[model samples]
Target: MKIYTRTGDTGETGLFGGPRVRKDVLRVEAYGTADECNSAIGVARAAGPDPMLDAVLAEVQNQLFVVGADLASPNDSPYIPRVSATMTAFLEEQIDAMETELAPLQQFILPGGTTVAAYLHLARTICRRAERVVVSLAAEEAINPELLPYLNRLSDFLFVAARIANARAGVDDVPWRKP
Candidate 1:
């Protein structure tokens, strides 16, 4: 198949269930940001050879695809896999497990450390953006109710993952300080 579909050349794209929307619409923005977060995680995975982090992030990357697809499809679309509470629970479990390996945070931290950790921090912010967009979308229409909680927990997971990466590398988190 040719890579160029040219269908979106006019600033519109089709949803999974035969609906067309402007490329700039909220749903598109939400899924696009989710895709961006997934790519950022991939970069973090490639930035270093941390097997545990890579394994966890690999699962997250796949889950993000489900997120993107859930956002891309209409609420009633039966073919798409909807985001679920179980997915969010998994992230919660991961965050709890990783947090146990590091010292408790007493102050705010900046988004920089080892390369892998730094990339994870970046992914965390992108995930936040995706979550915000999804929230906005949900306000206007019906969405998979579990999406918000999943994205919320996913960001928390990313934050702890970044810290774990830094800790495992013997790098300290860059703490925020008053100017």
Candidate 2:
């Protein structure tokens, strides 16, 4: 099928099992940000070739698609997978594993190091934005209860992953200095 479906030409998009909504709606915004986060993670993955990091990010990219689908479908859509606590736990597990390799944080750090680490930091920020948007969306509507926690944990995972990337690259995190 051609990429241009022309269905969204009227400024509205269809949900997985719900009616079309304007692209500017909170639900759309939340998923769009998730997509941005996913793409950022992809860039991070492409920036370097760490087998462990790449494996985790590959799983995360797939999960983010689930997140997007979950946000898009307002109704109970059998086809769309809902975010679950198990997924959040997976992120927590990864974070714990990665943190084992990182030095304890003594101070705030700037969001850059090796190219892969920098991209991971960028993805972390976008994940935070996606979390915020999801929060706002949740406040206004019923959402998967697991989603907020998942995004929250995912951001934390990204932060630690960035640190791990820097560690693997033999680069130190640039500590933030009070100016």
Candidate 3:
């Protein structure tokens, strides 16, 4: 079987249970952004500083795939697994755990560190973009409401994870202050 479907030659794509829509459809954008975020997480994981962080990043990569799959399905599609509260809760737990090991945030921090931390920062930004795309999609379509919370919390988790990576690597978080 060849990988090229060539079905999208007309600038349209299919959802799991719905008629094909434009490739630029909101659903496609949302899932596409999720895909982008997943790749960013992979990059971060490759440059990850510690074993524990590497594990967590790996888990996040898996979870993002779940999210991407969830987005790929139509709202009425029963074939897709639901992204539940438990997933978002897990991210919250990770965020809390990472925060416990970091200094309190008093200012906006610049994105940089060991290569791992920088890639984490990159992931965080992409996560935010994914969240925004999901938001825009949800505004018009009946998306899984859980997606909003998941993306929202995921961004927060990425932010803290980046800090934790920098901290553990003995790297400083560059802070922003009024000039």
Candidate 4:
């Protein structure tokens, strides 16, 4: 199929199983943000510091696509698969693994590293923004409970992943302290 679905020419796009909504709708915004996060993760994957990190990031990118799909569906639609607790659990597991390898966090850390690690940090920040937007969306409508927890865990995972990538790549994390 052609990339341009001129069907959205009028600033409206189709939901998963319903009539079109304005491209600016909260659902659209939330899913769009998730898509952006996925792309950012791709950047992190390409800058692989190790095989393990690359493998995990590829998985996260896939999960992000599932998240975007969930957000894109209408509330009344029962046909879509929802984000599940298992996914959240997996993120927590990864976070724990990465944290195990990181130095104790006594102070804030500035985001930078080998170019790839810095980019992962940037993706992590965008993930947080995506989480915030979804939370706001939930506040106004019925959203899958899994979404909040998933995003929350995802942000933590991304932070640790960035640190791990930098450390494994032989880059120092710029620590933040009272100057």
Cα lDDT tens digits for candidate 1, 1-179: 99999999999999998589999999999999999999999999999838987898999999999999999998576788888998999899999999999999999999999999999999999999999999899999988899999999999999999999999999999999989
Computed on alpha carbons, the lDDT of every model, listed in order, comes to 0.93, 0.93, 0.86, 0.87
TM-score of 4: 0.94
After superposing candidate 4 on the true structure, give the runs of residues whose Cα lies further than 4 Å from its correct spot: 75-79, 177-179
Would you estimate the TM-scores of all the predictions? 0.97, 0.98, 0.94, 0.94
Flag the better candidate by lDDT, 1 or 2: 1
Model 4 CA lDDT for position 140: 89
**Candidate 3: which stretches are off by over 4 Å?**
none
Candidate 2 C-alpha error for residue 134, in Å: 0.9
For candidate 3, lDDT tens digit of each residue in 1-179? 99999999999988877779998977888888888888987888877469999898888888888898899887666677778899999999999999999989888988886788788888888888888888888888787889989999998998898899989988889887778
Which ten-residue region of model 2 has the weakest summed lDDT? 71-80
Please give, for residues 81-142, the per-residue lDDT of candidate 2 as tens digits: 99999999999999999888988999999999889889989999999999999899989999
Whichever of 1 and 3 has more TM-score, that candidate is 1
Per-residue lDDT for 66-123 in model 4, tens only? 8998998866566777899999999989988888888887778998877778878888
Pairs of residues at least 3 apart in sequence or in different chains that clash in candidate 4: none
Which residues of candidate 1, in runs, are more than 4 Å off?
none
Residue 10 C-alpha lDDT in model 2: 96
